[model samples]
Target chain A: QNSDASNEPHTVKKSVLATYYHRKFEGRRTSSGAKYRAKKLTAAHRTLPFGTMITVTNPDNGKSVKVKVNDRGPFSRKLAIDLSESAAKEIGIYSKGVAKVKLSYTLE
Target chain B: QNSDASNEPHTVKKSVLATYYHRKFEGRRTSSGAKYRAKKLTAAHRTLPFGTMITVTNPDNGKSVKVKVNDRGPFSRKLAIDLSESAAKEIGIYSKGVAKVKLSYTLE
Candidate 1:
């Protein structure tokens, strides 16, 4: 019911976790296939060195969050990281439930 | 063991949930709180109307997040919102583990 898909021009290739946020609204299951929360700062990735710090910012609200790459994510081509619901709310994206955020890796 | 206690000059009397964030660093337990996930947006509160929206900002990095008041918290006099570990990370406070943040309520 929303038409906020105009700025997806870049279409960069991401891992399975890239599109993880869509699961909350779509009721999709995780790879280990357990229920995921959209409020945490946790994210899924194809393969990132563990302990890597990732900064995610909501383009609309300018809310930024730093996430530590902990475990591996289900390898896919669409998603990058699966954010916890609280993490989304911190960046003001939880209400809309989906946001186009900037994902950058910051070395520790 | 820490010198961050100087800001307690105007300590306000908050409900049970007010001093919640300290639990993680202090290894304190929550009331009836089964091992809670620090990554979720869920928060424990004293008494605010349900569905109220609250804005929490990390004073250090200026990172901010919006949270929905869901359940009532332990009736203590120290903590406010117990942020998930992920939420703290987003605001750049997880490593330090504690932050002084501004809390505001916004009408929906």
Candidate 2:
């Protein structure tokens, strides 16, 4: 049974380190051409298309927030998503500065 | 003072009819190529750029929800914005099927 399980196409939930956008970037144009707003629920992902909606969950507190992918990067090899200030707050990560998160998306 | 006010570039908040996306479209592709999820806090605006975030306010109850513009159109001349199911619920419009809302966006 263990060997069969290993051979199966198992879907593992990926966890990544997350950080948030700085207020300094507010009003600046993101790579996708939309002006970044710190108060908006938005995020930056390296490969997700602009307008992609993602659920970012903070495993520590079981809090989660939905953020739209509108810009490009955290630029750090260690991070997976860069959320806006409001997005981070929604998931209880604003006060912490950073958190380990699991990302989820629905397939079409 | 009235003449001066008339001459000034006065910004008037526009109010329009708003509706929510149906759950049947949950996994379909939006105009921006991202998959639509009815539970996400997103909206469809005719002219707004993809990824633009707008504050949708339901003036009757003074409730509001921030939504990202990810798709296009109510396709009706009378409607201004179409919220996702969750967005509609956030602003207390989900049960009504439609609501009159004021749209606001910040300039860069």
Q: What DockQ does each candidate score versus the true complex, computed on alpha carbons?
A: 0.06, 0.02
In candidate 2 the C-alpha lDDT for residue A85 amounts to: 35
**Model 1 ranges off by over 4 Å:** A1-108, B1-18, B21-37, B77-108
Please, what are the lDDT tens digits per residue for candidate 2 over residues A1-108?
Answer: 123334444322344444555446768776567887766777665445577665555444445556677765544333323333334344444455445543322111
Model 2: fraction of native contacts: 0.00
Q: What local lDDT does model 1 show for residue A71?
A: 32
For model 2, the superposed segments whose C-alpha errors exceed 4 Å read A1-108, B1-12, B77-108
Per-model TM-score on C-alpha atoms: 0.22, 0.32
| Residue range with the least summed lDDT across 10 consecutive positions in model 2 chain A | A99-108
Residue clash pairs of candidate 2: none
Q: What class would a CAPRI assessor give candidate 1's docking?
A: incorrect
DockQ of 2: 0.02
lDDT of each structure?
0.37, 0.50
